[model samples]
Target: MNWSSAEIGVLAHAVSRAPSVHDTKPWSLEPRGDVVELFERFDVSLPRHDPTGRDRVISCGAALANLELAVRALGWDAQTALFPQPGRGDLVAQVRASGRAAVTELTSARYSAIFRRHSHREPFRLRRVPVRRLRALTGAASEPGVQARLIDPRTETAPLADLLEYAAEVLKDDRAYQRELTAWLSLPPGAAERTSLPWAGLVRRGTRVPDRITFASRLAQEGLLVVLTPDDTRRDHLHAGAAAQRIWLDAVAGGLVASVVTQPLHLPEVRAGLIEQLGLAGYPQLILRVGYPAEAVPEPVKLPVVQEEAR
Candidate 1:
């Protein structure tokens, strides 16, 4: 492996910037001799929102994808093994660095997108994504066991909007869930504590997560894609995350912004509603929205992205 100590540190920063559930970063990185091992820090996971640890593993998978891209951009061939250690659920994946190669345009574009990609929550400009790009996105979203399905708002806006709004109300009224969510926004990842400030309008709250109808209206006008699997096991969620990360990076590479909608789907009602509305065969793991970003992407909170070290 051609990775140096400094390069490993840079790689850690890249992986750290990977989006987590509610920006909680429910994972940790340990730089071994040649490969960096990713572990789920279960303490930081959201118990009420993600009781099954699906989102936690998915968060690590996204980091795994970002780390692999950064490694390739640095001219190394990265080999990854999910759950390399048997029976160790915390060990999400192990990425081994070996050999060396020159960076290609594809790799360069993806690596660059790792920095530009953010889970944008605002409305996208009402524009149809190109057919070629949509095909490319679906291809990007495909991994070993995961598949992507596109939902056209024009064809199914009624149920989509209604379900979204209903899920929002259900989630907002759940005081326990709201309290857990508020805790994350209050302290964030590393902060000691917030100064008792109001969190209603401050946090991103992801795609009408706070019982707002306007966001639902905007969503019906935007492009939606569902990442699904035949079995909704923890392993499937991890793979789903890798696919989701690839989709987001592809969108960013094509000058589009994206975000994942999982909160509302956490409710069984929403999931059943989605299955009925879209007639999807498999378990819907995540809903990804991709479109034109707002004037400015929100600042990264607790994402330790190394601007200078990575380069």
Candidate 2:
């Protein structure tokens, strides 16, 4: 089947629904003949939280996965090429329509979740996710090259909580870091409007701040998982993104909610520390907090897919 503008538009809309860090949709798409090429927009990088820009790429990778799945939902096989060239830093993935293919029931089910999944920051309900359901989430990470492990031990949990407390304290004390966070945080209720983080989504500053704000709260209430890769490379990061979206969509299928934490894992020292403290043997790409949310919000806004000619 030949690709058309309407099909490309639907695929683009599905891609925009993928989860991103701090609602930063760090990607762009260009329709090249019959293929949709995805590029990582580095300008959307959160310099403070992601200095290395690894999370930015991972977010884009997740977007690429969504694009691929969207293509499949349209009865087409998506041929994807990751980081096609060495010098082109922004290029993430190229998805071309190969031919007509049957979209599996699982894929169709997950497609619904693609647009339904949202990064929830509010507190979760008292209901604990079933162990089997949690395992299904782990299974979602069973891609070509990725590993997802749920952190359940008290010994591992304690230190992770400590590290998060320390990181939060440090961030609070560091003026520059605070300024950067403030810039991202949304304005107060009924206050002046600004281009910042959505205040409604943020944990309030007072004692009422949700547990998601503090690692301890996350540890106590939610089911936490550590996303890891055997090797620390660009390809591994991309794989992690694929694994993350898979898990996210799986959670949606199971009526679960998830939120990702990269702030603590941003620092190399913190990453290593968490590994040592948790006695884990691989590089931690993201810390996923999952559970049934108490409240659900609308999907985050995303930039429209803009097609541009190759330079």
Candidate 3:
């Protein structure tokens, strides 16, 4: 588990690229002896959109996956201990390097994809994803306690579209929600990032349409899926997050892009509607939009990801 300074930096860089709820990288890494510790930066917790810190913990879990993948791709086996101590919610996980193994092409490809994964708002290409590739995406959630399923776009389109609109109506009048949402948003006709980077808005505004109806309508033409679990405990939430990162990484390896939408599920009614409409046998933890990018993605689009050094 003794890691060189350079290896630690590579691991940190991989974790930094993980997707968070609002580009808020809510995790940090520390090298302790032979183990690399991943901790949750709860200070960035979103009260309006994520009341229970579920998304925050989930975000950390995504980073955890990336950390492990980076280690493996570098030819080291990563042995992880999740939630190593009871009642210590701040400690997301601890990972230590084990004996070296030959790095497989698959691992290298997935690791390379970590740097290229992104979210796009534009409609995907007209070509539908091959069934084999779609299945591989869901298979990434192979870790215990997680299950992923692709919703039948042909059957669930109308109701899925309605749920987006319903959730919009449900939260429209809440000023707190609006304020926090605006705080994270960097785009619109006149909106810009807090840092005054005008072009930053263009990247942040991916797939985020002004009208919910239009957003839902456009979504119908793309890939839609969910990651779910049989339980709703904290551990399950973490598992869901790990599954999400795996799916995203796999999508990237297959020349696809994705975005996540979990705000609407925060409302119980919306979650229930999803369960009833989709006939889910478990709790849905994340909703994902997957597709081939319709237009070229800008290189600067990924520069604004907010990450912090270990505290």
Candidate 4:
């Protein structure tokens, strides 16, 4: 059950790089001998943005994915149990080093991507992601009770844009929500004008959303994936987040950049609309925009490495 300083460092490095809601990193880690425990922090809440705290749980799920990958990349057989303690809702997952295994090229690539992956909020390069590559990305996310689907630019773009437009309107009108969003962005007083670019991010106060047609046109050129689960539950949300991180790491390792879009999906109506319009087989938890970066890659969000500590 003993862990070396290097082993503890790898686990912390991977988890810190996980994408979270507003970069809140709402999770903590406890390395207990052979088992590493991940806990969801209920203390970190985004009231107006994430009313039900679903996104927070999803964020922890991303961290869980990184933890498992770090364990495997370090040559351990990571046996993960989600919500192992039924009474402790906040404990998201526990990864145990059941045995030793040689690290595979794929696992190493994904683990390396943990640091390379970052949010690319701008438009993608004017190039199409090959159908084969897209298929591989989707396959990486095909976990139990989880499904990753690519949006068809040819047929589904218009309807998808309609939903996004609706979400923009809904978010724009909510003053409290806009205030929360602005606070998170922490935009300088004069910097608001620079955010007018199309597809910069989810809509906020004073940000102009392109018309439906224009928005659809821009979306048509982008590669989008929707992560879903058969039912809406805490378990499902965690699965969705894990699936998302796997796909994202795969994308990054393949020289692509991506970002997760859960803000728009936070609205009940938007979720209902995506399911009905897209004829989705399950509930859409989040949308990931993946593609070749159009310009210089933005720096990855840096976090302090995890220190060796037993809980």
Q: What's each prediction's clash count?
A: 0, 1, 1, 0
Candidates in order have lDDT scores of 0.73, 0.72, 0.75, 0.84
Model 3 segments more than 4 A misplaced: 188-217, 296-311
lDDT of 1 by residue, 1-311 (tens): 33466677768777877888888888888877678888889787677888877888888878888888887877778898888888887888888877777777777777777777776654466685664666679888667879988876566656777777676666656778867877776544522222111111222233234234554455566677889988987778888898899888888877789788887677788889989987988999988877776565533222224233331
Model 2 bad stretches (over 4 Å): 187-218, 295-311
Order the numbered candidates by lDDT, best leading: 4, 3, 1, 2
Residues 1-311, candidate 2: write the lDDT tens digits. Answer: 34576777888788889877666889999988778889888788567767888888788878977898888877778898988878897887889888778878777767778877977655578786765667668988865658888887344666776776655545545666556666776656633222122211332222132233455545655677889998888788888988988888878766788877777676667778988878786889988778886766445323233343342
- Reference-based TM-score, model 4: 0.92
Candidate 3 residue-wise lDDT, 1-311, digit = tens? 46777777788898999988888998888998668999888788679889998888788878988888888876778899999988877897999887777777767767877888876544568777765677778989977878888877567767776776666655655678767877886555533322221111122222232354554455556777789988998788888998898888888777788877787889889899999988998999988778887766433112212233342
List TM-score per model, in order: 0.83, 0.84, 0.85, 0.92
User: Candidate 3 local accuracy as lDDT?
Assistant: 0.75
Q: Is candidate 2 or candidate 4 better by lDDT?
A: 4
Residue 276, candidate 4: Cα error in Å is 0.8
Instruction: Output the worst ten-in-a-row residue range by lDDT, candidate 3.
Output: 195-204
User: How many steric overlaps does candidate 2 have?
Assistant: 1
Give the per-residue Cα lDDT of candidate 2 at 243. Answer: 90
